[model samples]
Target chain A: MSSQIFSPGLQQALDLVGIFVFALSGGLLAVRKNMDIFGICVLAEATALGGGVMRDLVIGATPVAAFSDLGYFSTPLAAGLVVFFLHPQVERINTAVQTLDAAGLGLFCVAGTIKAHDYGLGFVPSVALGMLTAAGGGVVRDLLALEPPALLRWDREIYAVPALVGSTVVAALIAGNRLTPLNAGAAALSAFAIRMLALRYGWRAPRAWHRNDSRTSEE
Target chain B: MSSQIFSPGLQQALDLVGIFVFALSGGLLAVRKNMDIFGICVLAEATALGGGVMRDLVIGATPVAAFSDLGYFSTPLAAGLVVFFLHPQVERINTAVQTLDAAGLGLFCVAGTIKAHDYGLGFVPSVALGMLTAAGGGVVRDLLALEPPALLRWDREIYAVPALVGSTVVAALIAGNRLTPLNAGAAALSAFAIRMLALRYGWRAPRAWHRNDSRTSEE
Candidate 1:
């Protein structure tokens, strides 16, 4: 895979946008948790960069872009500031925010797959990493705030599935050597559309087949 | 710091021991949660390797040791099997389990600092990484199981502080050019002792100063 498959500038701009959108979710969660500004910023940064940092680390990308680039570091802080001043207003329009979040997830998963592949990861690992890059931030945010991650719960509306599909599509494109800007965009759009549909229709995953509750069995 | 601080064989042995102990905690938690054997194994692996993986990633260590080495991957599964069948006995001895956990924390923190420093991080970051190395797995475990991280809540017992101290001691020893194995052992022991004392005394952190409940304000 080429090291710079897409224009670096365009990719970076897309990354910053994804970071900003993810940061908003983190900041909103912090406000909901009644955390102060410092906690809000911390959560925002974690949410925005957690997955990318994790991906970079696994692939041995040194200094991790989160620390090496000032823009990556500051984008979350900007989101935090925005949330701090206008949470009520932001909270009121959560559906719009969630719609944007689906878009962010789509872009992140596709980008994550491409980058992981560029770093020499195999098809399976790249697809897995793409989903992680899309959902990892929310895991960090929920962990910090003591909320159960929606990604892991069977009862929650399907979230990670779309990200997985997006990543898998990107990986497939990479495998076929037919990866182009238009194809990549279509892959991301497909993922975004799936997420939006899941949201619209309230689709949810089922529990393990006949999952038995033995809560009382443990003393 | 030299690339190899201690004998590689000895360091690897110590790491396996720590991994096993951490895996025990993860497995036990899964049992308590009433998860199946597979859940036990998954949690065990996550808790055992999560911290070291995080440290390695930040330091640009490619192919992270946890995935590169078979022993690193398997020790946790061994722990999971032990917990799966013996949880009843293990839960009966919670205090002893916690003692082992403290010991594991001490060793991991020191090792984390040493490795991070060897990888060219400065004292402050090395110490910070050390603490993360000690606590990161527990955080991952709790997040996966939908529990609040004890490290974050002021109401919980002082767990991370001891790990921080252990890492700091290691960093100071490294900075002072006196990082013999004996001194490293002492650093680890000191951290272990502090954690044990905290547990024995039921020590807990205080809430924010003059913090008034403003929960109703949000609604």
Candidate 2:
């Protein structure tokens, strides 16, 4: 039985590119947090692979692809090393990284959704896992850095929304028996475009209804 | 192919207890952070099952036991509800909760190690997964709360150490063909005692060689 939505070589190439960009974001965060070299590498690896690792585990893919593939392991370390030496230059090109991050988000969400479908997950949970696969690494990185998860923060530009949209699009195609490389590419690109637009526009999720509602309700 | 190390009945009970206590900790943190009811529930679930889910995914245990079991899904919600209503009283019993948390840590590490071994992970990674299983929930909790991971904080009591010791003990037994309920119980209890003692004594992990060393190294 065919186990993947895309050809193995194409998927591997997409996966590596996504891992590299996400790792850069993570490594930059570690630099901002003033962590040591080891900490930078840890954050990089976590950001690059944490979501995919999470998705694999939930779907029962044994040993995780990261654990099995030396490329998955080494890519993040390489990103971290680059960030360690040239964070100032990296910081100057922040827009480029955000755009790359958007592309990575697109690739991850579509890939995650397809993988979940292959594992027989239902629509809702599959979509959720797809977004998790796209966004979970940043959550892990932010947590390690003692910062609010950017995915959940209302102040941040819309992140998970694009991933969710891409996942939904793919899921809909799958349910309609129209899934194909062309459709998958369009779905991922849609997510990437939306995320890049959100970044460019400085879009934010709505905040709580009341500024103190969370605290007042408890009291 | 047997997938579990403990009897089904015993495992269910132990798992439930661990989930309940960990969920309580997560819920309390949410309340402290002034999160809404939904946030409390989210944190509770994350803290209770995050680690095991992570371990299961790594080992290719599909559907994660939590997703398959309604009880696992409901228990954490119940814990969150209780914390929501009785956070004041819950905070008053902080010491009791800490002790229970220690017990949960002990149970989780041993259980995680055995499960990893069952999944054919080598010794070192199995033990690491065991520690992750024991502490991953709290790390998730702290991250959700926008705080540093408790496990990584040098000022915090030595948390991973006890879990590591317990996992190592169990792994050693498994390797030596001496694993049994009695031996497992002893190993878990030994971990529990060590964690409890560390809590009571305010034990801390050693800080870096120099406070400015990390920053200086980068420059």
Candidate 3:
């Protein structure tokens, strides 16, 4: 329950890194949608902080950290501005962005699980909250862009699965009284590796209904 | 700060009524979109409880009421099921549904303002949260349907204005030490009337730019 495992400075740094990468993703989506500068900023902020805000709210931490900390609020705006002028350059580094995004996902899932457990949630809810904290921002971003959420698409590279794996590992470690900063880092690294591997291998979750099954139903 | 202003029975009844109407709207949207039964239920639940859950989380009420109360969870599913089977009849009563939706918006806005105040938020945030409570579910519903949020569109019948008015009324009453159950009911009624009037009159809020304005920008 103690928030002392990761020092305040380390936590803040991790949070900022996650927020920055997520904001970049959101800004790219906004550009693809042909939205204006204001729209880009809005989406960027939502993608960066929406998940964390949701997590904080559910766990009774309010006046959310985003509102309390000026840096958290401005970081996304800065990201948006950076993308506004340098989108062409940013697009060239898509692979780099994806790598950083994987890191963000790993960090958010582990941190969210820890926060949920600290708030006294049970194991299952903690894991669910962790996934939400990792993937909820992208969901919000896609929704705003009027696209199906990438999280729910069976065809996409495994997204929530990695977050789930990391969260479960963190939860199991806590339950076994083996949780330490080193082990938590390892948990995040595992998620990062899983996500990167999935992308590299074009791994996807299975679809519920096969094309031939639907054709047979039609007949 | 006490949650006792509205009796538990009365609050529960009001909440159920609001949820049912919101869920019906969500179900109707799902039907229009040709989503399956599971999708209908998911959208219905999101439309009915998303706003309240958001408000509750931001105000530090953990484990949100929707998660704790079985009735809150089930009511939306019931509405979705009803709509799945009887959407033709439900669509026929579109006017009636809109009337009830206005009522839901009114009730939610007032209650949200009161709760935010109790949670020690400032006046502006309380009112903002109230508007979010009134309109947030519908926004989520539209986003899930891959449409622009109704609140942000200039063409819609002034949806958020009534909610803002009602929340402000309740907040001012509380600040004046004249808040009573009777007065709160009157506040909600005021919102309901305003919304209905706007619909009836085909009233629209003015947009900052016209279609020609964009053409002028090209010059």
Candidate 2 TM-score to native: 0.62
Q: What is the lDDT of residue A158 in candidate 1?
A: 93
lDDT of 1 by residue, A118-174 (tens): 998999999999998999989988878887787887767898889989999999998
Q: Is the docking of candidate 3 incorrect, acceptable, medium or high quality?
A: incorrect
Lowest-sum lDDT 10-residue window in model 1 chain A: A210-219
Provide a comma-separated list of chain B TM-scores, one per candidate. Answer: 0.94, 0.94, 0.94
The per-model DockQ list reads: 0.15, 0.16, 0.13
Q: Which candidate achieves the best DockQ against the true structure? A: 2
- Top-scoring candidate (lDDT): 2
Per-residue alpha-carbon lDDT of model 3 for A102-153, expressed as tens digits?
9999999998888888888767667767887898899889888977777655
Residue A219 lDDT (model 2):
20
lDDT, candidate 2, at A47: 97
Runs of candidate 1 with Cα error greater than 4 angstroms are A1-45, A54-60, A67-139, A143-219, B1-4, B206-219
Clashes of each: 0, 1, 0
By lDDT, rank the candidates, best first.
2, 3, 1
Model 3 misplaced stretches (Cα beyond 4 Å): A2-53, A61-114, A121-128, A141-146, A152-219, B30-46, B53-93, B121-128, B144-146, B206-219
> What is the fraction of true interface contacts found in candidate 3?
0.21
Q: Which lDDT values do the candidates have, in the order given?
A: 0.83, 0.85, 0.84
